[model samples]
Target: MNAKMRNDAYSIFSEAIAAVDPAACIYRSVSKKDNELIISGEKYDLSRYDNIYAIAFGKAAISMSKAIEDVLGDSLSSGLAVTKYGFGNCLSKMQVFESNHPVPDDSSVKAGQMVHDFLEKTQASDLVIFLISGGGSALLTYPRKGITISDIARITDSLMRAGATIDELNTARKHLCSIKGGGLAKMAFPSESVSLILSDVVGDPLDVIASGPTVPDTSSFGDFNEIIERYEIGVTMGIGGLLEDGLEGVIEETPKAGDYIFEKTSHYLVGNNSLALQEAEIRASKLGYNTMVMSSSIVGEAREVAKVLAAITREERHGVSPLPLPACILAGGETTVTMKGNGSGGRCQEAALSFGIETSGLHNVLLLAAGTDGNDGTTDYAGAFADGETLERGKSIQLDAHAYLSDNNSYAYFKETGDLVKTGPTGTNVMDIYIILVDMF
Candidate 1:
């Protein structure tokens, strides 16, 4: 396997993900008009719906809400946009609630209450414009009847560090929450609902995007209980009460396929990781590199995937595989990283550091791994990049890539080496985007 081509490919791929910033994309997608909103090929005339209101939540909520405000500023009767802390900006007509991520905090609980309050006052003639995207799950969190915010936060963080899949984690979340799993949809019932989703989940399952607050639940309490037991997670009495209610048919079930709540509801998947990958492919091809989009929903442990991809690139470069030199390989998906240390990096950073150490300055090889959400793990940097020179750069500063990887501190390593990719809150999330560009034959 030729090591250099593999390294260069990965580096170029990272650049490609960084190229199409989501905030810029959202800004471009929206424009203002007097009585209409044109979003992702759907044209909604404000006059058609008797009453129009906005409800948006996610990592990209601030930017997405901004776009919504521009289009439906005067027409919107009331609206709420919730986002993580430190990402708020001014907006007209809509309340911007800055909250927390990866786990729901008190602000998240308040945001959930706000949603409930708003929906409680809604009428059948009202139109609810649900602007949902990745991170909405964490942003729209509300504990069930008896659960506490701290309990939710602890469970969420533990599940994340335990390397649970997003679906598994969300399944648990849906059961524990009052507004997730179709609970919001239940509240918005009998109203005209329109959900515009920027999917971060692989395959863009409607039920999995933001835990499908406005969608039906195919997984029931039994399924949720199974996952909890499998993970050995503690469930509070509040969650237990909800489960009992569900079992006894005391509370109404979430909207099913033929539910009346969906009578006037429609869902649009505006964007996804695959779209981002396709855009990257076209751009790389235009840049004179042959591109292959591996998978938009790539999932696995970050380091293992990085090493496997490295090996594949090496094989391709040595003329043992089909693709020739100067090729670009792309992958988009959320990778998991089990916390083995007090590392300060996310999956993308860990992947980058692992790739950097394994490649060890092999000429012509570079890699970039980053989350599409703009924040990777606990760091502000979206992700990190590494090439043939990355290891050498680490050595010059007496930095041990291996040690950093052990501690899961790729953010520190990449920051010291000046390879961290920074894009503040890309108002969209499809998943992580990875690009592997091979420039050296």
Candidate 2:
């Protein structure tokens, strides 16, 4: 391994993650002044409210709640947070629940009930400070009257394996759950609420991130049906029946673009992939590398994205764009992986494997693709690293990179090559980071 170059890649990525630190993001957007609660310049009078409550969920749940609690202090009457298991923490005043991610489990139902109870008893004079981040869609959930967690899990897991986009999945989720698609915001009706969000979805679409717990949802039953048909998803948790009733005017549509339910509800994006990429750009420049922060809105299949990135690196190395030597190219966003084989890798690892294959002879360039949350898909590592010699090393070990990529088993390939990037449980979640370091040497 080229320790210096690899360390540089990790350095830039780390700086990016720090810039979107959940705690810092919360502190930047929220503050307490005299007798007022200020959020992103909007103030809600504390005098009118009997108590201020804070609740957050996602990978960033713990750090975010800590910042909120610090700002509110003793004035923070109560709070709660839900995060993926092994990421929970002990807060001074708020309760924390750890749940499953990417798929809702029974504990997710319990966490949903906890939030339900919190919102159910809220009075008109009370205020809710909500902290929403990536992964919340599964970390916090309450099924509709008859939908069980297993039902929700089956639908979600199937869609994910089928490569359904986050928006498509959230659209289906809205119809089946009572708490998604603005349902949480509705529950906080009559009480003023503000949500601080750390976006992980591509394009930062408000309604898609964490299924838009606080924002008004524009997707309807019709939209849900469209996604099901589009993705060819079967067994939609009886969402067809709900959409049928909705189309027949029996079930009320989800809160629309301009609903009174959102009158006092405010949503602010505290952190996003773009913000993280910008920070990475700054760090790379300081390290004597000519940095180009590519689009943070990158979206596509993992291997295809890898092919494009590798092509760009090839172009730069060959003077196509005439980029300066020692170039650091970075892109950020979430990518999808369709499970074609019983694979053992996530999207980032797959991308890394593809990159290694594409850059086999381009000696002197290195690439690292990793999830900011420190967990990639269902794997134990954040992501993986690759370079020109990766394929050669694999062949030396009697491993085949192309076969692994075909099987969606990139994790095993990188493991054998000792190239998996493991940063366990980073407390923040923005999106995935892809960095390519090109050196003339």
Candidate with the greatest TM-score versus the true structure: 2
Q: For residue 102, give model 1's deviation from the true position in Å.
A: 1.5
Error of 1 at 283 (Å): 2.0
- List, residue by residue over 224-315, the lDDT tens digit for candidate 1: 76766777777667666776787677866555677766677778776777777877787677667777888887889998888977876666
TM-score of each: 0.89, 0.97
Residue pairs with clashing backbones, model 2: none
Instruction: Give the alpha carbon lDDT tens digit for every residue of 129-222 in model 2.
Output: 8889888989888988667788889989988998987888898788777778999999988898988899999898888888888888978888
Q: What value does the lDDT take at residue 391 in candidate 2?
A: 96
Best by lDDT: 2
Angstrom error of the Cα, residue 49, model 1: value is 3.1
**What is the number of backbone collisions in each predicted candidate, taken in the order shown?**
15, 0
Worst 10 residues of 2 by lDDT: 235-244
